[model samples]
Target: MQFESVSESRLSFVVCFIAAFVGCAPLLQAQTEPAAPHTFFRVKAAETLTAPVSGRLLLFLKPGSGDKEVSIDEFHPTATYVAAQEIHDLEPGEEVEVNADQLAFPKAFSELNGGLYEVQAVLDTDHNYNYAGRAPEDWISNVMALAGWKPGSTAEPELVLDHHPEEDAQRKAAYEKLKGTATADVARLEEFESPALTRFWGRPTKVRAWVILPPDYVKSGGKYPTVYWTHGFGGEIDSALVSGLRIYERMKAGKMPPMIWVMLDESCPQGTHEFADSVNDGPWGTALTAEFIPWLEKKYRMDARRDGRFVQGHSSGGWASLQLEVNYPKVFGGTWSTSPDPSDFHDFTGIDLYADHANVYHRPDGSAYPIMRDKGQVLATAEQFTRLEQVLGPYGGQMTSFDWVFSPKSVSGAPEAMFDRVTGDVDPKVVAYWQEHWDLAHVVSTHWADRGADLKGRIHVYVGTADTFYLDGAAHKFDAVLKGLGADAHFTYIPDRTHFDLYGVGDDRQGLFDEIGQQMWDVARPGKSWKNRQ
Candidate 1:
């Protein structure tokens, strides 16, 4: 057995295989059982890669018109046949038969009668399938049309795996166009590498921030108040570059005050770390407070005092900013967090992980817990998302990202899973660790006497009632705790608003930026009215 090094290409291929296997399961019944009921389905797939491929294989099945273009999002794991297979040194042009009995199927698929279905085979060469978007290296098999197919049907369609070179070219061209259009104002964004992070990872780790300098700074020899803006999950330093440019534009136009904005990037391979000092994510809170902030202050013309420093973020960033303010009260003057991720674990995404026999997949009454949504309609369940992610490998995803940030390290050198992936059994030990360390509400409630005085009137949170991820539940829980303790924390709930548009005030989507800027200005320059801005 020869093991190969796992490169980006190989990981991508492996992930593709995982996705394909999780999507469809082919049936293969034993030939010895002549009188046995037909209880199997199978599909034959051929590899089309130029080089010999050795990785995982995935098969997907969906109820659709076989002539139409198939999308991976359209097929749900619960309603489809899904299976995985491991291959070693499989040469190009080799065909393999995938058996359905070895695959996992939802209850809905078990009772399915014979019908029309489309089957596809995904050959993942590198195990990084979930992150790859229609890349040519992600070899996908031709959609096989199975009409009137029942269990143990001998009519199996042969799928030929092929790459989409044209799509890849188009994606590259679009990215190049975006890069070419970046103006001189965008060049003001500076990137920073954190020594703390490098030491933690035992390698050079870089974190970027868009440092928008105050206009006319070369002539104006004065230090300015700083706003440390954190980005939410999937947000990178480049993504916030436009916001920094807009800030410069607003300042130049006299629509906003002259203040420095530090757009910090909190994204990691495991998702946004939320900058919480954790055993798993390696003291990010400490790094941000002790190392990053001090370096930033020294390098820029920033007012180093607490009164001049403030934090603001939305969603995951929101939770992080609030956490930073609460943890290091003297370091940051205040935090204006909006639509943050669960501040209270009691209502974490509407499911209490600490509950007895808690299962993320189902509610107490045995209803499916929703995850992805659009306009209040559920697109996928929590279980479906988790299962798909599990197939996609454990390193980089929303669920695993939380584990990397909150859970303790396991003997396997990875973060301990909060719940069993297959059974959805809540791990009592993990829950206890999360509550003690990561749960903001629990931390504040337990240590109110010590930290309460400094945190008073400094913690301001905003959330929409119709937040797509049900983040409002956690916000409400945190609000109750704050009110009970007379913590002087401000909590606002907007009506009929969703997470994406929480920042929108009236008609402008970027209105929240200006609103937050004015609020920060008010805090930095007390007795100055925002209405009387020059």
Candidate 2:
């Protein structure tokens, strides 16, 4: 639930139908004419936009009397028969007929037995579908009543495309409310366009952060140390606001030193970019260091030197902070990362992607790999999550998010998938690319001679022994490499803690912030205690 907990809104009912056409040219020709040996399923799509519609058509099938209203959260992609077909040159106000004979089931579902099933369809106009819900431009169809569906049965349903005005209004109102609720201590949203990112994206790309000034800033008029805080996957500016408030409360109570907390927003359409420079995510690390930090230092009364700048984050953000300190040792003084995503691919969530015949679904002993749970009980397996994400569309899931930040860009403008979706086959070539570029342990161990001096005593990591995602396995691997290299790194293993409550120390859920803030102060002003402050 690491990435899943960020968005509570149920996934919009969106399914992808990947049809295998034995004869491609004949299938296109058969759109106008009928072809033998082809099972025909037809659908009609009505568009609401003025522009022509072009995207995939998703078909979902469920057995028996399906739930009257199905949320994407309740729907299991593995249990349902999902397929997709592309519709092109579809005009608005025109209900176009689509030939379903061209659609084919995935290899796993190819041999499914015919039976009574409930069906639904969605027209993804933008081609970007995620679990968080649909954009205003996307369209969905009503669930078809249960009916007998056989391989050759010619059953067609009509689907209408319309905007969810209520949902849109709700989203807009929530954002407006968040903007209006900012306190005096928690500064308003600050955003700027990064030139490096803009050039890479071929458009103006905005980077945003919340700048929380210390109490009595104008009266004091003194430079303060800065903490660059980042959020985990699916997190937004609002998520950072809570942390900013905690920092303000602690400063006001004299529990911590007065410091400027910069809560950075790393969430994007692709997923949490984690501010790592990649071929897919562009030069985020470079933009953050070369552009965002410099502008922030000059704009505010900040201590711009390396000793005064610190980094901290959890989960994906944790990985980001760790990478930032290791990659640019001179830029930031230190990083305190907690329960970060896989630091070593060798133990990436307890599965080695580089191992021979490695499958994400099963172990070498053929046992399932656990994904989400509490205590020792397994709530979901890795295959269930990955396969579910596959049917949810190609964008905005944890697995695809990693590919976006780690894998090389393919000619199709999408990141080359690191594993086969159906078979869970790990591609060694992609693993090699990951190791040479984003593998934190590999990078640090290989380049210790050059970076070791600057990075010594700067790297600190913590993970729970019972992390919900099994992240501690990778943390152990990473720590072992650092130890072997004689690096002065700190790795803490908290007993009985999980990913969700790692920040808590006893009943104080926000205790970690106080600890991290003080640590930053110690690094900034050595031998100086909070007692020495006025």
Candidate 3:
């Protein structure tokens, strides 16, 4: 069970993002009088801009033969061909090229299929496309039609960033819909000014959350134990409301016992952070334990003691809840984490960092490593995920987010990456730093004699045997470590489940959560027998 586990609009040169078969990029052979010009997509910032704009430039390409607009999104089934070029100043009317030689994912221009395509370019003005996607100030180019574009074609397609993408009205409408789902007094979206975070970011940073009170909250005149929740990567404050509405509906229907749910927003421009206090990510742990919790207790009838505040989450939020339960054992009652990220680094999405000459993208047999799977079928590779992140920009992608949460701050004042994005070589120094500070298995084993008493029986983890991201390997290792230490922790690996559907194991869709709610209720209200009124 051994485990070694972003600044302003700064420039980051993500080199050669295409992995494994990067050499497959076509080379122009000398057969004709003039070598065919390499296929490329040219992008330019608008001339109407008042000042210089600098950030990661992204190009999205999709099939243009259909009437339906090509939707560009993350984690698509048929991965899109994306290319990135970091540009600075990008003086008005000037062009920056994302050629076949630049960083790309799945395929570069020279490797994409020959066809008519719709190509659009986005200037991530604040370098926050991973979090906010195409935000308000982000300069986006209109989709330009490319006819008969082929690998190594002499034709060059161009996109002009003369306008911004449409505002996120759908997201806003969804938020409004969620608010309407419950009574105005029952749910609230609140923002807290964290003294710790404000100082760390050198700005008035606020922690936003959706607090859903119980149905009987005002009428009961009694305190309620709280379930603190958060989301994984690509989630924001709006996501908290969606979760809150679901919780509220369940409580109103009496499918589950009523308890206050505090859906925390852990998403940051730098990534999920997982609420780990880091040199680069700031003291989010301290902000939660010392500042946010106490503030919540006073404002509401919250049973804010360790036994009454239970933490639960999925994926990155799952890791955050587990860390909170471990680090501040006296502050949280317990944790019910589902399909969390790499809890043990020995099988970090299936790569051992401690192994000699560790490589994330390949094995000693010269085979590419698979990062995602479903129904025993490989869906994506580790190389694809990392390369895609490199194309998405440096800060908010899952791999770099782990860096922000786990690694030591580099000389440039940014969180150092644990591995090279281009080479796939694990950084020994960063791994060593991660093991000491963030590796949960090691942290529990090393401090068992000192902190085991408070932590025993407080940790509960649920993962799937067929996790999409190979997270089950780490969970198994960490579970073994816990048993070896004689720590009374609960770890469950549901058979035939993946990361997305671990909770629907039993007859009920949310049977496991009901059990968790029952357990927390018993701790908060001893001998009360507060079962679901189903």
What's each prediction's TM-score? 0.79, 0.80, 0.87
Q: After superposing candidate 2 on the true structure, give the runs of residues whose Cα lies further than 4 Å from its correct spot.
A: 4-51, 56-69, 74-85, 93-123, 141-157, 168-178, 183-185, 246-256, 410-414, 529-534
Candidate 1 vs 2: which has more TM-score: 2
Over the full model, what C-alpha lDDT does candidate 3 score relative to the true structure? 0.78
lDDT of 3 by residue, 1-534 (tens): 000001111011122233224562432122224634556777777889777788888877777754222334444524567777888998888887777445666665675667787777888888877665778888888777767877665556778888777866897887787678766568877788999999999998877788899888887888989999978777888778887787777777776678999999998877886777989889999988898888888999998788999999988888889888888888898998888888888878888888898878778665788887779987777777677767777778777888888999989988888987766778999999999988899898888888898888888899889888888898888899999988888988888888778878367666667667777887788887544332
In candidate 3, stretches whose alpha carbon ends up further than 4 angstroms from where it belongs are 1-37, 44-54, 67-78, 88-100, 151-154, 167-174, 182-184, 505-511, 531-534
Worst 10 residues of 1 by lDDT: 1-10
lDDT of each: 0.71, 0.75, 0.78
TM-score (C-alpha, index-matched) for candidate 3 = 0.87
Q: Write the per-residue lDDT of candidate 1 for residues 409-455, one digit (tens) a residue.
A: 99988899998776666898999999998899998888889988888
By lDDT, the best candidate is: 3
RMSD of each: 8.6, 7.7, 5.9
Model 2 C-alpha lDDT per residue in residues 193-244, reported as the tens digit of each score: 9999999999999889999888767677878989898888767787788667
Off by over 4 Å in 1: 1-60, 65-69, 74-90, 95-137, 141-156, 164-191, 214-221, 242-256, 372-377, 528-534
